[model samples]
Target: MPDSDLLLIGLGNPGAKYDFNRHNVGFLIIDELARRWGFSLSAGKWQSQSCRERKWGSRVLMVKPQTFMNRSGQAVAEFAKFYKIPLQHIIVIHDDLDMHPGRLKLVQGGGAGGHNGIRSITQSLGGNDFFRLKIGIGRPGRGEVHPEIPVESYVLSNMGAEEQEILESRFDPIEEGLRTFIESGVAKAMSLINSIK
Candidate 1:
């Protein structure tokens, strides 16, 4: 049996300014759960902001890296090592442009695609053996990319009110997914949520 309690790490650029962006949905989910369960993420440790909570008799540690998006792995790796968490016990929650809004995907051990945060984590951990909970952000509108702009700016930028409305509705299922991940396992959570439209 895995001795390490599952560690759920939310990926995003930290700070008030970056809070509401499409890329920050992972952080938003953690924030929503914290609010619902009354946990404080004000603590600074493991190069990230984190909170510890008791849920369904399991100890849950929710992490948000303060190291910005591109270099998120440093904090994550440290947290995993310091807490003695095995790769099998860590779950990363992040935004995915590929999945449509209100869609959720859960996977174990995969490449980071073009996500700098996941890339960094993989680099730091020296492998892609960790669990991932990908929340959809959808791709940008037609012809939005241009020369000379950094992806960092694009990801950290906030979504509009209409976009936010769509995402705002997704919080419930995502919250349930977290609970299910703890109560059941990744396989059960995947079967339950992915089976939804």
Candidate 2:
């Protein structure tokens, strides 16, 4: 494939049990992208559900790995190898607990920040060089509900209605940020997305 071809992977666990969890924000974003771009990831392959579409004159492969969150790198590596997509041309979307709810960050070549899915991908790819679109799910604060809960439990929990509303309201901006990333590249995307409150 040409350098213009891109691979977009959304990290999430499979099965209905995880469909609405905070960690499944990547899956939600993938669904929104498909809806906006007119593609269906109904086909299963490479341990994922995938679809290809032409976007900004380049072929974009959207994939949701079914290998679960921890082993996501296996699916990502397989797809990247098969498509010959370079690390810079790959983008992974997943949830972030460090940022406040509804905030988004577009970053490149960074540490996993304790995210198991990202850690797996970094290890499998031999580096942390891929672009990431991180959707903030927020962490427990002092005196907040479940402040004593485990991080794993918090991430696996479903989003409250208010939190879901906040996320839904930012979908348009997130979509625009993704478009900017695909058209103008990661630096531009990071500048634009990180500027958003």
Candidate 3:
């Protein structure tokens, strides 16, 4: 399996303080996936915590960058170079502010959409060909929606109980979608993940 045939990068700031924040949804998803797949975590190369599992005849490496959100690309680029992972085989899971909360969308080769983490990654990688699995946290102060909170504060805020429950509920489908991505390809993964309503 060449050590690691696929790389899954979850974008988030490290530390317990950011654990349940909306911006940390990527970390939450990665943690849940690691638990479900029985992948043990360890301090990994490139400023990240990671785990590797061999399944379906491939080595899947999952990482959560500990370099904080803005500098995530440094860790990602370093890891990818060390593993010799191709750009197309890398998947970055992160939160999105453009879509409604609880929505999931998978896309490849897109602009960062104002995400500093994504921007850093794109710059470090020197390309935008990697896959992105975006879990929507939505923007605040739109109409009557959370108007008191600023966008920065909103994302860093802990999710409301209802929001947390909603995201947890989608974990099953997210798992299935990731499995499909590994088994099939981006096309199938997109069909499965983007269709979630």
Clash statistics: count for each candidate: 0, 0, 0
Give lDDT tens digits, candidate 2, residues 1-197. 23377899988989999988999999988998899888999757778999988887678999998988999999899888888888988989999988888888888888889999999999998888899988888787634545777888999989999988988887888878777887877778788888766
Order the candidates by TM-score, highest first — what do you get? 3, 2, 1
lDDT tens string, model 3, 98-186?
88788999899899998999999999999999999999887887644587899899999999998899899889989888778888877
Clash list (residue pairs), candidate 1: none
Stretches of candidate 3 off by over 4 Å are 1-4
lDDT agreement of model 3 with the native: 0.88
Return model 2's CA RMSD, one decimal: 1.9
Candidate 1 displacement at residue 129 in angstroms: 1.5
Best by lDDT: 3
After TM-score superposition, what is the CA distance of residue 71 in candidate 3 from its true location, in Å? 0.3
* TM agreement with the true structure for every prediction: 0.88, 0.93, 0.95
Which has the better lDDT: candidate 1, or candidate 2? 2
Candidate 2 global lDDT:
0.86
Clashing pairs in 2: none
Candidate with top TM-score is 3
